[model samples]
Target: MSTCVYVQLRCRPGTTYDVAEAITLKEIHSELYSTSGDFDLLMKLYIPTGEDVGKYINDHLLDVPDIERSLTTLTFKAF
Candidate 1:
């Protein structure tokens, strides 16, 4: 089974669009949403089995610029 994670990103001032564009360019996320509140963007990612979750986030998601903070939610099973 694939591993799924939800990431919420807090972007630097006036940089939400840039950050979201970068993420979209990667073609990695299953879904992305612009949100109101503490986070500027929410992304849903699917990682293939045997991939390292931490490393994937660090290498891909975290590399985007203008991301000031991130919150990751790991999923187990779908009901």
Candidate 2:
């Protein structure tokens, strides 16, 4: 089955727009947007298998510039 991960991203101070643009350029995220609360951005990611989830996050999402922190949530059920 496919795996879905929801990521809460905190961007560096004064860099939200730049970070968002960078994320958009990558085009790896299923959805990405700015938001309030403890995070500046939220990202949805899909992978073909659960095993690739870790690598995908570490190699791709973590590589984005101006990203201060990230919280990843793995989906357990659709409904």
Candidate 3:
């Protein structure tokens, strides 16, 4: 089964849009949203089976420009 995760992105001031667009272009996220609080965006994604979660996030999301930081949370049970 795929690994489900929620990633919170913190972007450089005025660059949130740029970051969002870049991420959307990748077409890797299941869902993404703009939110208030410590993070500018929240992304839901499914890492394919056998993929390393940390490396997957680093190789995909972390490379996008304007993304200053990220926090990833792994899910256990859906219900």
Candidate of highest TM-score: 3
For candidate 1, lDDT tens digit of each residue in 7-75? 999999999999999999999999999999999999999987999998999998899998999999999
What would you estimate as the lDDT of candidate 2? 0.88
Q: What residue runs in model 3 are displaced by over 4 Å at the alpha carbon?
A: none
Better of 2 and 3 by TM-score: 3
Q: What is the clash count for each candidate, in the order shown?
A: 0, 0, 0
| Tens digits of lDDT, candidate 3, 1-79 | 9999999999999999999999999999999999999999999999999999999999988999888889999999858
lDDT of 2 at 47: 74
List candidate 2 stretches off by more than 4 Å. Answer: none
lDDT of each: 0.95, 0.88, 0.96
The count of backbone overlaps in candidate 3 is 0
lDDT of 2 at 3: 88
TM-score of each: 0.94, 0.88, 0.96
lDDT of 2 by residue, 17-54 (tens): 99889888988889988899999999998876656787
Model 3, residue pairs in steric clash: none
